[model samples]
Target: MSIRKNVLFACLTIIGLLPLSFANAAPDDVFIFSGTRLPTALSEVGSSVSTITAEQIKQKGYRTALDVVEEFAGVTVNQNGGFGGVGSVRIRGALSEQTLVLIDGVPVNDPSSPGGGFDFARIDTSNIAKIEVLKGNQSTLWGSDAIGGVVSITTKIATSPKAIKAYVEAGSFSTYKGGSEISLSNDLGSFRGAFSGMTTNGISKAESGDGNAERDGFDSKTFSGNGLIYLPASAKITAAILYNDSMLEYDGWGAQTGVSDADVTSETEELSGHITLSLPLFKGRLENTFLTGYSETERNYFTSGSKTYDYFGDRLLFRYQGTLNANETNRIAFGAEHEKTTSGRDENSIDSLFILYEIKPMKNATISAAVRVDDHSVFGSETTSRFSAVYRPHNDWKIHGSWAEGFKAPTIFQLSYYFPYSSKVSGNQDLNPETSKSFDVGVERAFLKSRGIIGVTYFRQNTKNQIDYIDGWYENVNKVKSKGIEVAGEYRLSDALGFEVDYSYIDAKKGDGNRQLSVPKNSGSARLIFAPSKVLSAAITMRHNGLEKNTYGNVKSWNRLDINGSYKLSSKLELYGTIENIFDEEYQQVYGYGTPGTSANVGLRLSM
Candidate 1:
């Protein structure tokens, strides 16, 4: 039998056997705010979504957002080197740029970036409360650049009267990490802030197979702050900011035209902030929110300490939203948003209006419809819509389905390329915004008595006007198709012991029937956890990264195992440890970039 067919059969047989091997009840206490822009039960959302809570982050030793989302289905992460290296994420076969990333619901994608995508490498998790991931097209509610869905991060804002938390860690390659968080809450308002930094004498990015000796290193610092002032009549004012500065040394292509140097360096700074006012009126039936924010990103690349190139991107956002709780079962929401992207090249602005209605026809069913129209200064107009429904036959089984449209505007470089060299690529001024239509259906079963839960989802997305190089210039000539299946389950044998597994299979291709680059066809991840007592908790996680075609060659599948644990020694002190790549899996997520081997770290946290 062929390898692809064999792999498919093995995956099905394994997932098909999970329910019989273990038992558990609904693990749906997770509250999601991104799916509907309001706090809603996990089981009620019609999309395939995942959440990583603060507790889970600690238990799994998740140091970055990338670590937290690796286990999610239909997600693939690629790194250029070791810790703090450039990272890219592809969701459900969509292009990396298609995924919309938000910090506190504020878009952070760099407009100057090659394709205007968020760089996962720059994210820091100093005071994150949760990471919410939504799959499939979400352009209807979120507007453009959300075709692949959204990854929204919420930082910790709630505080005690007085609290301070600190942590430190040290390990291989002269690596060091530390962070501190402080919070104050009073009758009038609340304030919280966090600071973190990390530095490492890292590994070689370009491996010669004989063990390259050139070492690449990185240093970074991050800060987060949130403040709120409670006003009279159930109103509040809030301010928030996030910042990061980092420097990294990496290898550039060797002698090849597209390759970089061996000792290339990069320095970057990014800042995003927001101020908001919220009010509740009409006897708590009507609510309103107003927000404005700005984001700036700048990067400089150099060789031999001499700056070779630089780029800067900035964005501004203003939004107003209102919600009406019409009755016990009917809810309505509407919003208007304006966003502008500015690079040195051009300033483009877009105005968007959106509305969503949710209906609970009965106790066991919820139906929602959303529509959005975006008017761009350059591209004229585009409209998108979504319809979703969820039905619960009983407390244990939920069936859900959704149909949605997607849209993405052409990038600045793609539309304004004007290099003088004959060899330089040119752009098209008349390129249309890319668009897509997608649908998904899924079934989930939850058991009672805290036994366990299982879910399977099937999805398909067809995209048109996918920008590609045709006849030596960028054009919308590709029609791409992507389909996938996701199977996830969590089982608990006892109150203190449990296991989880998530699997994804994707068949993605471009118009000419070529496999998508950097997209894995089959991948799976599993985790086992034990919490024998209130003071002790640990988990072992295993992940499989499937095959893909890359510049380095047809990369093979690889697996890794990581173990993390925590022990509470006292009310004010705790110890934690993590061992990564336990079996020394020497594989690469991005070809040519060296992957880390087995490494261990120890840390301590003091909290009050």
Candidate 2:
């Protein structure tokens, strides 16, 4: 079937189910931080946001952050090969480099990268408490690299007086994984720490069906810690740290042929941490926080057992934010930040100030406006702004809309890197920053005694001065436009059964009217969960992707099914297992890259 017909059918299907009686409403008290840089209720934010909590992560057995986000609408992920291979994510057809990734409120994009993009390959989900994805132009609050959206990951913290948890698993492809976590809390403070690791003799990076027989290998280790200290006089201190190390073997392109198996390996090490002090005054009517953060990444590449190239990137940040509650109807948030980034021997800095004003003019409405000004050491200054509103006419209905502007400065590598031996590619110092304007409007409704929720959103974005490799150098000579529709629904059929589904349709084009590459025009997922008792649970998920274009050719549409279940052996022990790609589907996300087939894993979990 054609793409248009498929989209029409999906839309009709959703419309057909509007009259059914179902219920699975989310809790009203749930709060998210990425929506406004404050703890805002999900219904109060106008921007498109998706959140995955710790319970959902555990129930789904997600091993990486990438695994969790791919299930959402309007998001796409591409991996070069099997486990530990390079991975990238795109939202609403934006480039991977345009998305800003954060770890505990700290930006973690690699400055040494050609486009300052973050690699999602090595980010495990061991210590994650929740993930919030804010879509559309978000530069008004996040600064650079927010042209696409923002992905904020928050690590776990102590919530109980004392707790300990551990898990171990082994699966196909000679894979093994394990993790342990401990937490302690008291009246004075709280602390939590976790460690996780994984190793696998993975499938060939090149297509194994194409006569490639060599097996690539991957290994990774991660450690995370968080602490909170209570101080006198309504003051507090918080600290967090994360460290990761990984090694991956990949394939190289042949001079005459395409992807070929080769002995190429890369090692990466990264460390990131932050400290914050919070103070409240005026009988808690005003609040302030000061923070300092640092991140460093090092990468080493080798071929034929000899080192070939290395890159280092680091960032330092200092920030202060204040919030004031003038009355029950008015509030203000203001902040200033200074960040310095270094790649190799070159460094640059940016200073920024931003403010947001929010007002509740009516009983069931909230409106907010924000603006930011940033001064870059190399490229002068840029300004961005956003406006948003949310209204609840009835107890079960919500209407929301947002308009925002964003900009991305040139990356250090894009502006200064030059290779004497490579004549085909080089950096252009005259490139300009890319700018974007975007808007989204959506409506959500609850029905069947508030046991079900359905929502539909329409979003559009236009970007100018897009930088890309043209002729022999990086240049700002392109423009792009993307528009999409997102539909999401959740239903509880009974006390023991539930269903969830999401679908997206995107139309993306370049200045020359060509469709964007590596973006699927249609995608969706559906899951059915069964929990007859508190001790036993199971779920089946089906995911589908439409046709996509790549440098080599068009990638055929594909579908995959996965099944997972868990059984509580006792009050302190549980057993779980999963079967992925149950039919052993043979498909590729990127042309010439290999994908896993019919993999299975089993594990035991202990809690105390």
Candidate 3:
């Protein structure tokens, strides 16, 4: 017998020997075509996936991207200021720079930033249609920044012919926001354009009138647009552009012994375009996509500091899907990408190619393998590979496992920046990328009758030649390990009520025999939702973060509650309100920084 046939028989035999818990009634309906590609149900993916739909965002009453991440599962944001504060995302207890953020499938990691982390203050979640978070090491599917995971933000696709929507909200600290979106569609294609502006007089951080810091806040604005062209057959092309300009004033770093005044202003622009073509080839559906993008960042500091950086890149992808036989299926994808970053200090670039294959030898069984090779301008060439599997004896239960290898390239800021601090501080222009391997296992189940889902997953990651920043120095550390467990679930009590709970625990230490610092070891969220009527909806959520103790002898912890509600007056208009920090909690994710308290926001949304 052929190898394909042998594999199919073996997979079917294994599925037949599983427990009855694997048998379950399917969902009432499928929400997205992409969800089926994952190993878990839409709700049970909490261990590795956190999804928030556009409707959820509207009902939650959030403003910035930072707000969303703060409430997301397995996510923690260290806020440095109020709404405009610098923020970082940590997944599986990884560093901020290890995570990757994507807007419509384009990377947003700043090439010139001090940490290569995307500035969350520049993102307004109001315009996002859907957000899908793939946690764990996804480097097998995505490249580079996938060492920790990937967060993909998809914009709203226009289907209506013509519409105009706008919203305005105001709250504490003289905060206010206003924006409008217009969509137009016809026989040839569709177009969507939006402009939003926000400003805040900002409140002082000190309590009881000890406010010495002035202009130590954030103010910013953004404009974005997108266009889609549909062909007669099954082909489409899309383009997107966004620009953000802002000014920030903050207390200087304690590097100089006393608080110094700092005023920083900068501008950034990002542009992306892609074309997709689908057709039948080799008895299967073939899809090809070509993408190109560019980003430019300019910074000006009042303390005689100025920098300009730009990056240009392109990528090509080819994917094929088909059925191998009566009870077998397969998918194959391959791609290549290249990027060049230009700054006054140096010109750096990377070229990479990868291929992946997924096969279902039998019903409810899937196996995938992938490999990638990258050529870096400074680090020569390296290769990585991954293997994973999912076994489903029935529709409701799945067993998943994976082993993967990934690496991260050093950003321009990490290589060239120099500062005045300890004499041991230094930046290595010849620094090599950090490399690591990860293993993960999980089980997921969905109970359709109760509309409930649950999942448990454990992950371990080991790294060698890790890069880190300490006391103004960038150094290469060796042998770091991290292990964690996540348990999450959701239940639908009735047509009008729902409940969700998520928790994560992690343990990590550096090879130098010190604990990784500034990361919470335990975190959780509990949410309750109510829809008393078709036109009205309400929700309440509580967040808890366990104190994290660092080797430097520092500990931090926080808890907060939020409530939101919305009422629809008609088919085209709705009113919403939210109260954050209902008890006026005094807390900060980062030491010495205070968060906004007891703030309230109300707004009206109009569609069509």
TM-score per model over all chains: 0.93, 0.94, 0.85
Model 2 lDDT per residue over 1-608, tens place: 13223433432332232322222322225364788876678888888988998888878777788888898898988888869998888889998899999998889898888889888889887788899888999999899999989989998887766789999999999999999998776666667778999999999988898777899999999988877766788687777888899999999995432688999999998877777888998988888989877777889999999999999998888999998989988989999999999998889999999999999999899999999999999999999999999999998999999999999999999888885655744567889999999999999999998889999999999999888765457888578999999998999999889999999999988899988888999999999989999999988899999899876677788999999999999999999999999999998888788889999999999999
Candidate scoring better on TM-score of 2 and 3: 2
Over 1-608, each residue of candidate 3 has an lDDT whose tens digit, in order, gives 13223333432333233222212222214243222223234432222567787888877766777777766656767766565666778777777778877776667676667556666766788678778777766665666777777777776655466778998877767777888988766555666678887778664432212344554555677766666555555565555655577766555454322233344433344333233333434443555555654445555554334543333222222222222222237666677778666554566777878777777677677777778887878877878888777887777887887788878888776787666675854466766788888888888888976499887888898877778876677877887888988888989999899998888887877897776766778888898999989899998989888787543334467789999999999998888888988998877566555567788888888887
CA RMSD for every model? Answer: 10.7, 10.4, 10.6
Cα shift from native, residue 276, model 3 (Å): 5.8
Candidate 1 backbone collisions, by pair = 23-451, 24-451, 24-452, 25-450, 25-451, 25-452, 252-260, 252-261, 253-259, 253-260
2 or 3, greater by lDDT:
2
Worst 10 residues of 3 by lDDT: 19-28
**Segments of candidate 1 deviating more than 4 angstroms:** 1-32, 208-211, 255-261, 418-425, 469-473
- Ranking of models by TM-score: 2, 1, 3
Q: Give each model's clash number.
A: 10, 4, 0
Model with the higher lDDT, candidate 1 or 2: 2
Instruction: Answer with 1 or 3, whichever has the higher lDDT.
Output: 1
Q: Summarize candidate 1's per-residue lDDT along 165-272 as a digit string, tens digits.
A: 999999888889999987766666666778999999888876535346777899999988777666899797777778899999988875422233376899999877
